[model samples]
Target chain A: MHSWVDGQPVDSVPLKDRGLAYGDGLFETIAVKAGQPLLLDRHLQRLNEGCRRLALVADHGVIRSEVLAYAVALGDGILKLILTRGDSLRGYGLNPGAPVRRILQGSAPATYPPAHGVEGIRLFPCATRLAEQPLLAGLKHLNRLEQVLARAEWQDADHAEGLMLDMSGRVIEGVFSNLFLVRNGLLLTSDLSRCGVAGVMRAELLAQAQALGIPVVVADVSVEQLRQADEVFVCNSVYGIWPVRGCAAMSWPVGPLTRKLQGIVRALLDI
Target chain B: MHSWVDGQPVDSVPLKDRGLAYGDGLFETIAVKAGQPLLLDRHLQRLNEGCRRLALVADHGVIRSEVLAYAVALGDGILKLILTRGDSLRGYGLNPGAPVRRILQGSAPATYPPAHGVEGIRLFPCATRLAEQPLLAGLKHLNRLEQVLARAEWQDADHAEGLMLDMSGRVIEGVFSNLFLVRNGLLLTSDLSRCGVAGVMRAELLAQAQALGIPVVVADVSVEQLRQADEVFVCNSVYGIWPVRGCAAMSWPVGPLTRKLQGIVRALLDI
Candidate 1:
């Protein structure tokens, strides 16, 4: 693991990193393919946007260059970027001009989730609900206890992921990925303006579907709507996309839309 | 700082500690006075309840012993108790049987907000609002970006704390403390069952208020409500109760109720 405190390597962070204190940080996980970070520009864009929203500095070019360097050294692995509001003397009030830190760390030979891309996978409808707060929504910050607790609901390996519902009982997304369902030729996914991660892969798929003339609807979804959908799939930057074969007992047949999306992501990432 | 992982002294934690990853952990910042923890039992109760909500673990005696042993030699300072579901192979999913790790770090004397328990404070209403999610509303888990971002809004040392409102513009509390207002003999504040921190001090004040025959109403409060308030104050475990002299342009006076509550807290913590 490599880290930079105020842009310099450090043995340990001051125990008061806002990231650990109040999760006052943003992160990005990317796939390192053939010494290249897949969707590097897009990841940097999101990271920059998050920092901008929080009024933190955005050295887009430096972050992009540094992350690529770390990924290339690993040959083939996962790259994670964590940018935090450095340290404070003590208290919730910000110390103007406090140095910010960037941490680039991950393991080599990133293991993709099962061969479910070909065989498809199952999902469980978890009882845990994702909380909605637009101020901290979309951007992937470290405040992920909701996801951690939701994912802990069950440990069924067969179920590749668990579907999380929002406080309104609307199906939002999966534990670590975004959910999409095709019904009557329209692609449906939860709106991240409320809850759920705005996954880079999910964004890519949305653009691809728009170019393909497939209607994409971003709104609330009920369990019944998911059960009646023609097909379902969950996606993330790492796993590309995995078709949902069965949710509990209801099953999906891996429709044309699902397969096309998988192919598009593969071509985009050259996985 | 003294620290440990799985009972052995460690230099740093795996970057994947759920604590740093998702704030998928519970923590208690206790005031260690005279080599002993102040309000130890109360802090443990809150930590235990948070663990149950996240379904982590709660062997109170075990954690208590660990904290005491590490804090015995320490004089006046603060002890942070971070309990995270031990390491997992990098996923949001929790292993029900995952070992829980305790991180006990020490800090030197605290420098609290100036004018504390005295001249009162001036606050700014922050645009970043806390979301009302009854499930994770009160527990002081790791998911606190909203507060951190709000706190980062300014650097005016004399400005004191920032007031956080919900998305609907309803006044919630400060970035770190529970707010209380006295108006026409009634002490009112926002309810934590839906949003805001259930500060350890706030809870004690409620019980003490009942004993003193003070009417403490926990309900939704708005900016207008605060403007009409006669007196206002904020409290947390470490800060006891600090009166509010002004909020941006609107001003408030320190009332008898605010002083009475602070007197009770001083007697309790023996500050």
Candidate 2:
């Protein structure tokens, strides 16, 4: 494992950094393969949008260079980038002129059961409901306690992921990945305007689906609708895609759509 | 300025600390008066409740002793105690047996304009609405991007604090304080079961109000109700109480009840 803060090969951040104080920051998890970062554009785009929404000042070009340099050094791994509003005194007020802080951490590629993708996996049916907050929704900001709590709902090997719903009972995303369902041959994903992280892999898959002439819909998804889907799966930048075989009382087969999208993602991630 | 990480003097935290990674933590800001942490019991009670709700394991007895020792060494200042779910790899899943992290940072007592406290301060009507998440509401856990965004809404010194409302247009609290309004000599504060931090000063004042025979109501407070109030004020452990003169198109005089409560809080904080 290796880490860098502010482009320096360091493993810690200042205690007063606003990211630690109030989660006042943004993060991106990128898959690095053979010294190349997969889906780099989409990841940087999301990070830039997060900074814009949070009024955080940062130079995207510099960050891109840093990531490229870091990836080349690591060869192959998972690179996590954290950009914060920098350090501040004990207050919510920002120091208008403070420089933004950038941290890059690298780790060996994660390993998961091969059966998870080939045979699919079950979801824990999490009781934690995502709050609807359009202001902070979908940007991958550091305020992720909701996901932390949701992931804690189950600790068994039987469930590889958890299905999360919004406060209004609308099916959202997984605890960590963006979820998608295939119904009547249409690829559908929950609208993230109210909540959930807008994952880079999800965006890439949607784009690929359109290119392949597969009709895609991003709208509110109910658990009932999820249960009625022909196929279901979850996707994230790191894992590519994990087919959903079942969740609680419902079950689905690894249909053609899920397999096709997984192939595309697997190729993109070079996994 | 001084700091400690897990009882050891340090100025930084491990980059992988969940507090920095996902804001998986709870914090309390206490006013240290003459080497004594004011409202220590109330602060610890809130921390314990937050830890329970978040499923974050920590020993409160050890925490108390640490706070006491830190406070004595840095008399007459502001003490911030942050307890995180320790460090973990890149994931939301908890390390079931990982030790919790404790951080203490001390700074000089914050100074505010005397006029703002005595003659009352204007409030900035913030556009950032808090999301309703009962699971996280009222617990001063570290997911505070809402407060940061709300505080950023106004930088001018004219408005000392910003008034935040929930997504459904219910007045919740100040950006960094708990809001209260008085009408017909009855004291009222917004219900924080849906959103907002339950400030230690707010809790102490409510108890004090009950003891002093002051009528207190905790319910949904709309902006309309706030405008029609006879007086308005905000309270937090650090600064005691600051009378709110107006917000947006509304105005109010600092009434007798505000003065009475201010006296009590001032004595309690020993400021």
- The prediction achieving the highest DockQ against the true structure is 2
Model 1 alpha-carbon drift over 4 Å, by segment = A1-14, A108-115, A219-228, A248-251, B1-11, B95-98, B222-225
DockQ, model 2, C-alpha based? 0.92
Best by lDDT: 2
Candidate 2 chain B worst ten-residue window by lDDT: B88-97
Per-residue alpha-carbon lDDT of model 2 for A1-271, expressed as tens digits?
A: 5698988999999899999999999999998999998899999999999999999989999999999999999889899999999998669999877899999999998888888899999999999899999999899999999999999999899999999999999999999899999999999999999999999999999899999999999999998899999999998999889999999999999999999888988888887
Assess each prediction's global lDDT (C-alpha) against the native.
Answer: 0.80, 0.93
Candidate 2 residue-wise lDDT, B5-93, digit = tens: 99999999999999999999999999998899999999999999999999888988999999999999998899999999999865999
Total clashes for model 2: 0
- The pairs that clash in candidate 1 are none
**At residue B168, what lDDT does model 2 achieve?**
96
TM match of model 1 to true structure: 0.91
